[model samples]
Target: MSWLLDESHLADLSRGATLLGTGGGGDPYIGRLLVAEAIKEHGPITVLDPDEVDDDLFVIPTAMMGAPTVMVEKIPRGTEPVLALRTLEAHLGRTAQATMPIECGGLNSMIPLLVAARAGLPIIDADGMGRAFPELQMETFSVYGVHASPMVVAGDRHETVIVDTGDDDVRMERLSRACAIQFGGAALIAEYAMTGADVKRVAIPRTLSLGIGAGRAIREAREEHRDPFAALAEFFAGTIYQNVRPLFRGKVSDVERRTVGGFTRGGCTVAGFDGGELELRFQNEHLLALRDGEPVCVVPDLICVLDDTSAEPITTESLRYGQRVVVLGISTPPIMRTPEALAVFGPAAFGLEQPFVPVEELVSERFSEPVAV
Candidate 1:
């Protein structure tokens, strides 16, 4: 079913996207404000399901590419993404029938909405990555035979660069990362132009709606004074992300983060109230969590940190010492757990020594005795 995405949906959608981002994907607050302003100028956006799109329709995925830390400090001019879209459309000599998110992360999730509203085009309710990752090549589109070129990138000052790497997604990532660094550590991009048929085959379906649902569940749980983490688990009971495990409840003890090579790379530790510690590592998103020197959860599974009291997600860039937080381990969609998908984004892809294990398996092995909620 199709639905109108107006300001009424922004809060929940942003909240859910932030959770799905796994501590990366830039800041949702900035993206939400951009969408709200675009809607005020251009009206609500139409969101179409993958099944509803015609097989021949041309769709372009749009997002911000850069370090999340830099993104928060270097705000977009609200014109960068649209400019990239227009440039890509011109390069392809075909008007985009619709726009979609390349990844379902905080800011990236809303970029397509902003582009769609401003361009008077409907947005697709799907994305390449069900969750966010740091690199351009870490998308299901790339894994399943979609080329990410000729890609168009636009900066805040209207600077634009077109990259045509054919099927060399790694080269594409390298060049685009360099471009982002040149653009002051962030730039808007439109890549992986695909036909509706390809979208149906490769894109994760209904993730936008899924994020909205997760956000709504969290909000309702808070209003009723119930456990938001439990609400989150209940909301994802039958979805692609089938399990949600609370890995640790603690206060942040230390952080060592740095923005380098167009990526925010770092690690942090959370000291459990009951006397233990959880270590989290990331490139742009939370990729690994270790408890007492043993791997608890590793990507491509999600490692999310939320405020203990409010269940509001905390991005990696926002993690601070003394914050009371709960770390979660959420299972990824099966489509993303496939051998091919893992090869592109598994723990090895991020240079982690631990092998890729399902979050459910890890939970079953490690949590034979429940520690706490």
Candidate 2:
């Protein structure tokens, strides 16, 4: 189904994206403001269902690249995403029929909406990554053989650089990361240009709506004094991410983070109120969560952190000592857990010695049943 995205839905969409982001994908608040501004100037964006698109329609995915922490300090000029889209279109000598997110998390989710409104292009309700990952090569599109090059990166100052690495997604990541670092640690990107048929084959469908729906559920639950976490779990039960559990409840004890090589890499320890400890390691996005040194959740599955009281997601960039949070383990879609997808973004891909394990299996084997929300 098609729907219109305007200011009314922005808050919910941003909130849900933040949770799906699993601590990265840039800041949702910043992305929200950018989308608000774009909508104000250009009107609401039309979100077309992936199945509704023509097989030959050209779709371009747009997103921000670099450390989430840097994006907090370095705001975009609101023109970069559209500029990146146009530059990519110019390179291909074909206009984009629609814009879509490369990842349905944080700023990238909103970036395509901003681009669509500004460019007068309808946006697709799909994405390359059902959840965000730190590198460009981690996308399902790449996993399914979509090349990342002939990509364009646009700086806040209107500088645009085109990267063409043939089918080398890793090289595309390296060159784009270099360009982003040179652009002051962040830039807008347009890559993985695909046809509607390619989108139908590889793109995770309706994730934008899923994020928005999750956010709405949380918001309405809070408003009615209901348990938002329970509402969250209930909402996901009907979705692809069916297993949602709060793995730990604690106060952050320590944080060690640094922005390096266009990425924010680090870890934090959360001391459980009942005495155990949960340690989280991240590379832009939260990749792993350990409860008393045992793996509770690992990537490909989402490891999200939400404020214990308010249920708002806390991004990696926003993690600070002493904040009370609930670490959540949500299973990834079956599509994202396949061997091909795992090879691109599994624990081994991130240099972890542990193998890829489903969050549901890990939760069942390592811990007692999750506490009632």
Candidate 3:
């Protein structure tokens, strides 16, 4: 069931889905220009593939939770996930045969192709974090216990909220981050109501064909200039953060935000590659990757920052002051090595004191470098 997929493979599936959006899948170039302007005004969008859905169908995953700097200053009015999946299919009386993707990184994988081309529905290509994580029960759907509040949410005007709660997924992420801070931060949910065989048993399979083969091998290694990170390490096998530290890339001299308990925490400080001074901390993503005080990196892994050179994904609330970032790290999210994702984003859940270390064995055995592109 392939309704559509051709705008040059959604620009190589938004460049390998923005490298698994490990930098906190937020900046996918305005969600790949809103999935190429909703596939050039809703033209192509069939793409179903989780074995064509049907094992009793009724899938449902959608996304865009909140704060990639308020999703580029609140842009999505695009009928909020088809009005939160048709108001959760009229409160679940049946009618959801397809439409998936909860994560594949950055702009939550072109927001299910602009919410399945403006909610005409039929975008089942699998997701649920084949990459990209900041929260929302960090993929693998609450590590199998799955259940994110009877779920349904559709804002940007149409207004809807479902959330059949029982105080699960932490009271459904505190009532979906307080309705994404009252829809000023972002919302559009449409969550976990699986079926298609439990959405292929907690997704992550064929994640949109691995975001179209990591967005067609980094757009054919940048049109043959070659070396799009060695063609994404020939489609990464995993565990490869070989000692990466770029606490400084000259600019962003500073940045800091705070939202507290509800979580928004932030920090930034770039200067210049190794002259001195460097600091990075974030909560909406990028946990810790210091240098002037030690601890090269920490968190459940991943510390990304990019955009230092069109690498993209920069959002510590739209970091500023020059803006040339680099920070990187990859390795984490196997359910963050369990123990309940290391008790919520390991290293003492960001209060850090030293414990977890798996940014690909802390970058191939403590920062090694030399594999540059």
Q: Rate the local accuracy (lDDT) of all candidates.
A: 0.92, 0.90, 0.66
TM-score of 2: 0.97
Pairing residues by index, what is the TM-score of model 1?
A: 0.98
Arrange candidates by TM-score, highest first: which order? 1, 2, 3
lDDT of 3 by residue, 228-336 (tens): 4444544554322223333334567888877554456777777765566568777767667775655566775556566654554455666778876666665543543
Tens-digit lDDT track for model 2 on 150-192?
8999998899999999999999999999999999999999999
Identify the runs in model 2 with alpha carbons over 4 angstroms from their true place.
365-373
Tell me how far the alpha carbon of residue 11 in candidate 1 is from the true structure, in angstroms, after superposition.
0.5
Candidate 1 wrong stretches, greater than 4 Å: 365-371
Where does the lowest 10-residue lDDT sum fall in candidate 2?
364-373
TM-score of 3: 0.33
Q: Candidate 1 residues 274-371, lDDT tens each?
A: 98899999998999999888888999999999999999999999999999999999999998999999999999999988999998888762222455
